[model samples]
Target: MSILLIDSYDSFTYNLRHLVENATGAHVLTIHNDSYDLPREKESLNKLVGSVDAIVIGPGPGNPDSAQDVGIIPYLFETFPKTPILGICLGFQCLCLAHGCTLGYLEHPVHGQISRITPIDRNSLFRDFDTDFDSVRYHSIYISTVTDDIIPLAYSEDQCLMAAKHAQNLHFGVQYHPESVCSEMGSKLVSNFWALVEKRETVPIRDSHLLQTEPLIKHFKTTLEYDYKYEKIPKVDILSACERFPDPLLLNSALSPGEWSIIGLPEPGRSLVVGNSREAGLTVGTWKGETKAHSDSLWSYICNHMSQRYYEPTIGDPELAKCPFVGGFIGFLSYEESIPLTVNKITSGPTPSTRLCFVERFIVSNDKHTFVVSIRPRDKEWIQQTKSQLQTCSEPRFLSSVKAKVEKPDKKSYEKSFYDCQKYLHAGDSYELCLTRQTKVHVPKTVAPWELYKCMVKNNPSPYSCYLDFGDARLLSTSPERFLSWNNQLSQMRPIKGTVKKHPQLTYARACELLKIPKEIGENLMIVDLIRHDLYQMLKEVEVTKLMSVEEYQTVYQLVSVIEGRLQDSIYTGIDLLRHSLPPGSMTGAPKKRSVEILCHLEDRIPRGLYSGVCGYWSVNNHADWSVIIRSLFNYEDDLCSTGTTRCFRCGAGGAITVLSTCEGEWDELNLKLDSVLGIFS
Candidate 1:
């Protein structure tokens, strides 16, 4: 069987596609609603539609009244009246409107909220189901009245029209999202739809007519090339080397000659990976809004380099196996590198939008042991020289204090943006918008980047903390959120959404209660759905392993959720997964593309730079890990404050803005996040 899913640029469209395939054993082809809306593509779209067994109009943003929103969806109903059709959310609204029904605004718009779905009658879509079931909803409009030719199948707890079908046509519509993780009996519901599709009487297409779908088939098919090889190098105890030259001293000396990337966490869960471009390493960078060639080469290099692994095989130390990185590409991507820009152009910054170094020599440490390793055929002599320096090294005296200045965000400007986000929410432009503001910090040039990072780590240690210096740019990130991480076995993403500041009156239980509120949970749910959409693109059997759990960080309590999926190595590489799921969903709001567009305008075309991007390493051991660059400080060469001796940095901070977000509440949350990083200066 075959199904054509007409996606309306919604994040949950893939979830629906996967569900339909699982329930009906059909090959599903998904295309954007506008993919074939052009006059030139109409005939091809018709041939494509006729080739499929059924058609599904998926949910999306915007009202059905706008032709721009619904695109060719309305055309499908008129042209193919006999085709079996199932419409969801925005699609449902479009379906109802075509049959002479009207859509009205919901008094309380629900996005990422679960509601009880009560069946008006046991139709084919809800057959053998409970009287009432729960399903997630993301809509601002609902069908106000039913047409005479339409049969109402279900209603929500609040008595809104939830599901309906045409009396004589093979068309069905549902107002809620059955593809959501929180929805109940979703598979059974999809199975019931399959039954309806089979029972409908329609003229079958000839086998010769089916050949017209070749173009569509080719569009969905993905081809991957791989060539795996391994080579062995040398290894040494990192702590033994660090014993004479501790991190403060060792990193300080290393930073002067070349670019450096460090990913470290505190002891107990302690692990640190440091690599530099001192020898046999290439320092490559792509500027903001640069052509795709530069960034593409970086991603291509990671894939090729990781596939051709170089390692020391004789050192079959079990401790080495536990370490995630042995030496590979270490770098950071600026926020602009991840998403399609809605604005015309991004003003070029002093540093590149993305920077990476192919590290041939590096040091890695875990709780029990530490080691310095290298990739073979190069960096051998450099390792010997580094070891000699470590042996004779005297602990460098680090400066205790550095004069600094902070430029706080203007409150009136922030509150105005908050209101602007609300206007978009009410207008159905977005369900949740992650609004952010940047704060400026200035420190004397005498303060070393390593020392600044060391102090930041002492103040706030995170699971994905790092100190990155790429010649022109430096980043000190103490982010608790893990954006994406995957090894040979499985891939995972932990997105942090809700936040509760730690206080004398707050308890763990109290924070739990606050995080579980409908508003907070809704914010997290939107991002969760967005991430599921991202994973489904390159993975199979995606699962939300943990949902809305309170995780305690150093200074605040955060609501974090874990999503995991396995990557089929033959079909998709870790780089493919990383590249496709850019600019973490937690940082960008739901319905990613639209939300990013809105953010660009609301933030006044100022590029977020590296502040909300991701920083991590793609390892030689076929492992990749990245963190959403939040609660972090970053500096570009030309962006320094108004003095020759002072070097300035930017810290981006914000909260997710939903319909329920208060102006004052969001302002306070933004400041609370800033303090976690900016406090080190104090």
Candidate 2:
């Protein structure tokens, strides 16, 4: 059987796809609603309906009454009256609106929250389920009135219309999300819907664009996780060993430029990955590392490279095999670059959109041991020199303090944007929009970038802290949020959304109290659902292991959630997952595409550079880990700026804006986030 899922640019559409596939084992195809104009041509509409036995309208943000928000959905209702159709949250409201039903605002909107619901009748969609159950709802408007032809199937505890079916047409609608991880009996609901679908003889159409065969996995026959002999790349030559872990800040600063990265700090760093470019190593783009010739988009090139070098790691030294980074590409994808090149046309920038280094020689340190090894035999000399440098490395001192020229987003301008955001929110344009601004700081030549990095970590230690020197640009990040991480079996994403600035008087209990409110919880929940959607797109099973929990950081207390999904080796690889889930949802906000579109105009259409991007490594062991580039400082040599005595540094900060947000509160949050890094200068 085949099903056509019409996506309205929502994050949860794939979760629905996963649910439907698991329920009926049907071949599901998805297309955006905007793919067709209103009144789809007679020939095109016939072809679209003939290809599938059933059609599904997925949920998304924005009002159903707006044509711009729901493209061709109303037309589909009229064009295919006989086709089996199912409508979800936004889709449910659209179905009611098409049948002369009106929507009413909820007294209190619920997003990423669960509510009790009961079936009025033994409807096919709720057959054999519990009498009363919890379903996840993410809507601000409910169907207030039902037409005489509409049969009510279920209702919420508050008497809100939850489910209905058209008496005249073979159509059904549900206000609650059956695909949500928190929803109960969701699979049964989807299976019941499929059972009611009228079975008809239809030609199996080949959707080459939407349905492709899963990629084949190349298995390696080796006992060790990394088979240097099997690949014939080189042998691991350990030149040095540090009995006691050295300060990453000092050790990283001593390395000479090529392309270098330090993934953790001495204070609170975990799963440390430290490496620099070597003449024998391989490099891509303009950054340091070994040299390689390539002409392609950055993401595709990395994806292709990782695919060829993919390996299976099993039955080795447990500690060594489990290392997150076992020598691979280390770099970032800028916010502007994360947008597909076809969509993002404005390319003016001082640095490349992506910069990565293939480190053959690097350091991998756990709590018990730190090993400096090289995969390339040619890097023996450089590895030895690196060992000598770290042994003799001394703490660097700053000659002068960094100074801020000015904050680009002054309070008046920020307030204007804040009100504008409210306008969009009140109109149901966006449930949550992450707004960001950049601050420029000036530093003298005498003060090295490494010294600044040291100061930043000393003041505010973060788990994903890193220092990157790409010759043209330098980035120092102390971000607490793990954008995404995956090993051989599973992938995880930890997104931090709510923050409470630390003060002497505030205790951990007090901070938790402040963050457990409606606004803070809503902010975190939106991102959690959005990320679940992203993971469910490719992963086989996704679960929210942690939801809306408070964690204390150096400068602030943040609310974080952990989402994990099992990896299907034959289908998508870690690189494929990275390519699909770019520009982390936490940074972009919920209803990601729409929120980003709105953010561009609000932030003056300027490239965010490296501020809201991702920084981490794609390891050779088929393991990867990345962190959102928040609480970061980036300095580059632009042609417009002077290079003699002082250089310009840029830092970006922002907060999520919702209907409950105030201009002053958002501004204070923005500053509080900025101060986490900006305080380093003082």
TM-score of each: 0.86, 0.85
lDDT of 1 by residue, 1-682 (tens): 7888888888777888878889988777777788764677788878778777788889887889999888889998878888899999988888899999987887778888999999977868989886699999888888888789788999989998889888888889899999998988789888888887754333444432221111101111212221212222233332234434323212211111112323221111122222212111233323221222223344455454455553423346765655666555667887877565743332233336766555545555444444445554454665565556544534434346555898989999888899999877876778899999888888888787767776776677666777776546778877888788887568899999999999889999999999999999999998888889888876667999999999887789999899998864426656666887888888879788888888988888777888778888776555777878998888876663536888788899998999888999999999999999888785
Best by TM-score: 1
> Model 2 segments beyond 4 Å from truth?
37-41, 104-108, 157-159, 200-203, 208-294, 310-321, 340-350, 378-385, 394-401, 404-408, 639-644
Residue pairs in collision within model 2: 259-288, 281-290, 282-290, 283-290
Q: Local distance difference test, per candidate? A: 0.72, 0.71
**Steric clash pairs (candidate 1):** 232-311, 238-370
lDDT of 2 by residue, 165-234 (tens): 8888888889998987778888888889899888776666654334332433344233232332111112
Which candidate comes out best when scored by lDDT?
1
Model 2 global lDDT (CA atoms, 0 to 1): 0.71
Stretches of candidate 1 exceeding 4 Å from the true structure: 199-298, 305-314, 342-351, 377-401, 640-643
